[model samples]
Structure formats: C-alpha cells, structure tokens
Target: MTSAGSAKKVVVLDYGFGNVRSAERALARAGADVEITRDYDTAMNADGLLVPGVGAFAACMEGLRAARGDWIVGRRLSGGRPVMGICVGMQILFAHGVEHGVASEGLDEWPGTVEPLKADIVPHMGWNTVEAPADSELFRGLDADERYYFVHSYAVHDWSLETANPAMRAPRVTWATHGAPFVAAVENGALWATQFHPEKSGDAGAHLLKNWIGTL
Candidate 1:
C-alpha cells in the first residue's frame, strides 16, 4: 500500500477527446496525483490510467491512434497495470462501434459491438441507476438505488465474451437500461470501464472514483 504522503499517480489521457480537465479535477479530488497528458512514458508509468472520451466512436479512435493511446492501453493491460475508460472511452474498448450505420473498428480489448440505443430517445442522457454485481469494487459501498450521469446514444447492448477456462474468473458486467438493457460498466482483469460519467454523477460519482483510486 502507498503511504498517505505518496498518493497514487493517475493519468487522464488527453487524446483529444472527452472531458479531460473535469476528469483530472475529479481524480485529484479522489486523492490521486493526476496528470492530463498523451505522453506515452508518463501514461505507462502512472499508477492508474484513465481514458476519457466524448463525441463519435470513429473520431475518438482516430484521435487515440494519432496519440498512440491505443498502444499505451494495450501495453499497460498486458502487464496487468490498471486502466479505466469513461463514456465513449468505454465504448471504443470494444471490437467495433456501429454509429449511423457506419461500422468502425475499436480497440478490441473486449469483444462486443457498440450500437445505437433502441429507445425512442436517441441519446440516453441524464442520471440513471445501474445493476452492479455484488463483488464490484467500483460500486462498493454504493447504494443499489444510487444513480450516475450518462450522455450517449451508442452502447454495447450485449456481452458475448464468456470465460473459456472455468478456473479463470469471468468479467464482472454492470447493466443499465433505456429502451433496452446495455452494458453500463465492466471490470475485466486490469481493464475497467464505465459508460456513465462519474465526474458528473455528484456524490455517488465521487464515491465511485474513490473506489477506483483505492484499487490503484
């Protein structure tokens, strides 16, 4: 465990998308020594890495590639380092994202497709509750009725990755619904992701961030 004087160092990847400044501030408040940068070495060396994303999946991927953020995430995960993704940052972790009928490739860290919500409303914005698993460290100590902020149209409606080896632990999946249920969060090994913006989710969000920071 790190000493109180040495807070966990976290990097909010500034890959030209998402609410970078807001994420940095939130992580700082969560007791992390936070830096917002696209520097490969700095990001790789951080105690935790947060990938924040906004806008379309294709555009986010484009920018991420330009900054080599994808490489950083892959390398970090290969070594069992902690990495987190928020909003579209979470979406792009999947294999593909189908937005407006255009299928774009994602990081492929997880096998899934991000498609538009089937709800009458296109973008499932605002606060909503999620069904997190009992063993979820991210949602630890949070109430079942606790809500988080979400602002997006596209999401992974189904989770298809099943653990091939019985001895290996399966990925913990969290679910939330609009017109239909979709993946709200995922904790798989070193990779963690949330479709909602914890930075925008008020006190519950703050608690969630603290939970993630604690894991770091």
Candidate 2:
C-alpha cells in the first residue's frame, strides 16, 4: 500500500469547457492527489491526466490550445500513460468533428470523428446503459445494467476499420451516424473514454472513476 503522503498525483486539466469541479471532486474521492490546473508544465508532471469537457468542439479545442496547447497532452496519450476523457473531452480524442457546419479537428488520440446523434434525439440526457466491450480493461468492475450520465448531441463514429482476419487486416475507419446505435465504447490502447458523465451517475459512476484511478 502507498503511504498517505506518497499517494499518486493526478492532474485534471481545466480547459474552461467541461464540468471542472465535478471532475476534481471525483478524483479526490477516488484518492488521487488532484490538482485542477490550466498550466501546461503542471499538468504534464502528473501520473495521470483527466480531461473533462462540455460545449462545442471548436470552443473546447481553442481552450485547450490557449491553456495547455495540444502537443503536451497529445504526447502523453501517445506514450500510453493513463489518460481519461469524459463526454466531449472523449469526443475530441478523435480526428475531427463536423458540428455547426464547421469541421473542427480533434486532438487525434483516437481514430474517429464526433457527429451529432440523430433519429432518437439530440443531446441524449438522463441515465443510459452501456455494454462493456468484450475485451477492455476499463470495464473491470462495471456490469451490463450499469448506466452513466450523458448530455450531448454529438457521438463518435469511429474511423478505424476492423478486418475480417486480425493478422491480415488493414483497418478501415467509419463514422457514427445520427440514429439508434452504439451508446458508448472503449477502444484503442491504454486510453479510455466515455460520452457520459460518470461523475454524475451515482455509485456506478463512482465505480468507473475508482476503476480508472486504480489503473493509474
């Protein structure tokens, strides 16, 4: 066990778009040494970085650039150190977004784009269930009925293609459509993300946050 003062430190990037307070509180409750900072150097030094975002893609991207730029966080995600993104923060991990008729580039940590949810509704609210990806470390303690909080009009349509044969497969990317489809997913490598607010989803959310911290 880690000594009290020797606990792992985590930095939550406050890029001015997401629910900063809720993330900080969640991290703290999960026993991370948390610091809410917009300073690039400070954010880069932590064991883990959590980016929680809300609002438009272009606006959030601008805030991250103005606050910490792209390279710093981008490099860390690429390095495979633990990095978590909630809601639109997760969406921005993809290659881009075509919201409001403007194609805004994402941080490119993941291979996908953020497109508006169509058919059912825009900005899916309340609690919705998510099935765990068959092979995922992020779903360690989460169950099938577990629901997370979501409030967004856009969702990810992954551009990464799946080949019939794992060894001979060249990935082809696809976009998520505006209709009834997958609600949430965890893909790529060590990175994990959600289109919902686990911080607002009671014990289920708490368990996810705790699971994420344990990974750190």
Candidate 3:
C-alpha cells in the first residue's frame, strides 16, 4: 500500500486498444500518479494496474496479447496485486467473447461468455444506474441512484463463477439493464472490472476511481 499523503502509482496499460489518455486523466484526478505504458516491468511494479479497452473484443485481445498484457494481468493476480479493467477491457477478462458471430478466447480470469445483449436497441449507450452490492468496495459511499456512462453492445448477461470452497468469499457482481439485465461491474479479490466507463461517468465515476485507488 502507498503511504498516507503519497499518490499511488497506477499504470494504464497501453496495448493499442483503450481510451488511454482519458483513463490517465481520470486516475490522476482520483489522486494516483498515473503512467500510460505497456512496459512489463513498469506495469508489474506499479501500485495499481488499469486495463482500458474500446472497439471489438477480438481486436482488443489480439493487441493485449501482442503487448503481453495477458501475462501481466495473470502475473499480477497471482501475487494478489491490484488490477482493474474498463469497457471492453472488462469483457476480455471472461472465458470467451462472441462478437459478430465469432468467438474469441479471453483471459478467462473469470468464467463466463461475453455475448451481444439481447436488447431492442443495440449498443446500450448513454448513462444508466447499476445494482451494486452492499459490500462493494468500488461502490463504497456512493449513492444508490448514481449512474455511470456505458457505450457497448456486447456484455456478459450471466455469471457462472461460484466459490467452490465454503470459506472463500464470493465475487461481488453489479448489474444494469438495457432491454435486459447484464453485468455492470465485478469485484473479486485483487481483480476489479466495470462494463461502464467510469472515466466518462463524471463525479460518480471519479468517486468510484478514488475508492479503488484508496485500496491500492
């Protein structure tokens, strides 16, 4: 953990697919010393690592692997280091993402499939509210009515990961609805993710980012 009064060092992994600059600005505003880089050493050494993504799931995964970001995330989680994903970044953490009738394998950190939302209107764009769990660290102190920015057509509609061990804490899953309910966010151990762009979500997003940074 960073010392009190010192900014946490956060790396926004630049693997050719995310809103890198936007995320950097937001994290900086949230009190972290942010760096935008794909350097393996720099990313692993940072107090917090954030993965941001936009566009197709397959393309993001391809870029991420080419940059060895998949290795970085897996390694970080092995040591219980903090890692967060935004937008399509969150999508690729699942087992598979089927976009445009093609299935691309994901990081599989969480078991599930990211499929197109069964919505009347595709790309559930604009602001929406989420049903955050009471014990969620990411949503801590935020109002229940607070909304976040979302711009995606694909989402994980079901969560299949369950704690096999009775003593282990279950993952905290947050939900939002378009034409139907889909995962909005998830918090499991050192790994955290959100389907919505907290960076673009305004004050509520800032608060959520601050909450994650505080834990770093």
Candidate 4:
C-alpha cells in the first residue's frame, strides 16, 4: 500500500482478451488512474499492475508471452512493484498449466499449478463467498465471512499452502477433495490473487480493491 495522497497509477494488462472493462471500472472507482496496455515501458512506469482474464490457461499464457513486448510482468514483479492477477490471469502466475497438457513458466508467486475444479458443476460461476485472512491488510475492512463473486472450473489445491477463508454464512466455501484443499486467494510481497472476480463482486469487491489501492 502506498498510503494516502499518493494514489499511484495502475496498469491493467490487456492482451486482446479477458474482462478488462469491469476491472478498469473497479480500479477507477478505487482512485487509481487505470491504463490498459501491453507496452512494457508503460507497464514498468506504472506504480502497480493488474492482469485480469477469463479463459483457458494455455491460450492465456500464449497471449501474455507474445504481448509481453517488454516482458513487463517479470520486470515489475522482480522490481518489487505491486502486481495482481485475477482468475485465469492469476492461474498464469504459476509455473505450468495442466489444462490440455500445457506447460508454461509461472511468475512463481506461490509454488503450485492451476487444476480444474472437480465439482459436478463444470464452470463454477455466480456469487461465491470468500473468507478473509485473519491478519492480511487485504482483509482490512472485510469481515471474516465475506461474499466475493467467483467463476472458474479450476483452482490451486495445496492445503499446507492453501489460504482458505469462508464466505459469510456459506457452509461450503472450502471444497475438500481426495487430494488436498485448494487456495482461494494468495498474497506474497505486494502481489495478491483470487480465484474469483472482485471487479464484478459489487461492494465487497470494491472495498477490497480500494484497500489494495490504498496500500500502493
């Protein structure tokens, strides 16, 4: 978080795909001057960066590597600048993609892979709840049981590393499986990611974004 009186600019990566509009709007409301670009210079110059997407892991990674123009991703993350990836955008932050046998290098924010949700329901959509981490600045104004919208068929499942919190009043926020518990959100340095869509999450999501922006 950058603190008050220094609302830094946020560059939302637009690789000709993903949910750019809603994200732009959300960031804008949070007081960040949003710029949707693939240019490395612009990304590097921006105070923070956001990558939002809705698609398969294989294709998303291909687009990122191609439009990497300046490899802005690695540049910013390495430089210690705050960066965030949402949904599929977050999935690409890992080392590889198990979807369709695709293998790619992740930003390595956390050690893991993005695997599909084994839920009877294919694409997990609609308003799902999100539990806030007890001590995360990201969960500052959020309650222990908060509702954040989610839509995905895959997730990061690693109980030891999985950061599980429940959505308010939701009994089944955690999907225990044969293997382990998956992660719903993760944070390392100034970077954070969610398997849900905060931009479309309405009020709770907006506050979460605002809190994140405040940190920058």
Q: Judged by TM-score, which candidate is best?
A: 3
**Backbone clashes under 3 angstroms, per model:** 0, 8, 0, 11
Q: What is the descending TM-score order?
A: 3, 1, 2, 4
Ranking by lDDT: 3, 1, 4, 2
RMSD of each: 1.3, 3.9, 1.0, 6.0
Worst 10 residues of 1 by lDDT: 1-10
TM-score of each: 0.97, 0.85, 0.98, 0.84
Evaluate residue 83 in candidate 3 and report its C-alpha lDDT on the 0 to 100 scale. Answer: 97
Candidate 1 overall lDDT versus native: 0.94
Better of 1 and 2 by lDDT: 1
State the lDDT of candidate 4 residue by residue for 1-216, as single tens digits. Answer: 444576679999988658888899999988898998888888888888898878788778778878982277777877878888888887887765687565656656566777867677767778765555556666687766677787777787753444445442211123323223456666666667777888988888898888888767
lDDT by candidate, in order shown: 0.94, 0.72, 0.96, 0.73
lDDT of 3 at 7: 91
Judged by whole-model lDDT over C-alpha atoms, candidate 2 comes out at 0.72
**Least accurate 10 contiguous residues by lDDT in model 4:** 169-178
Candidate 1 versus the native: TM-score? 0.97
Candidate 4 or 2, higher lDDT: 4
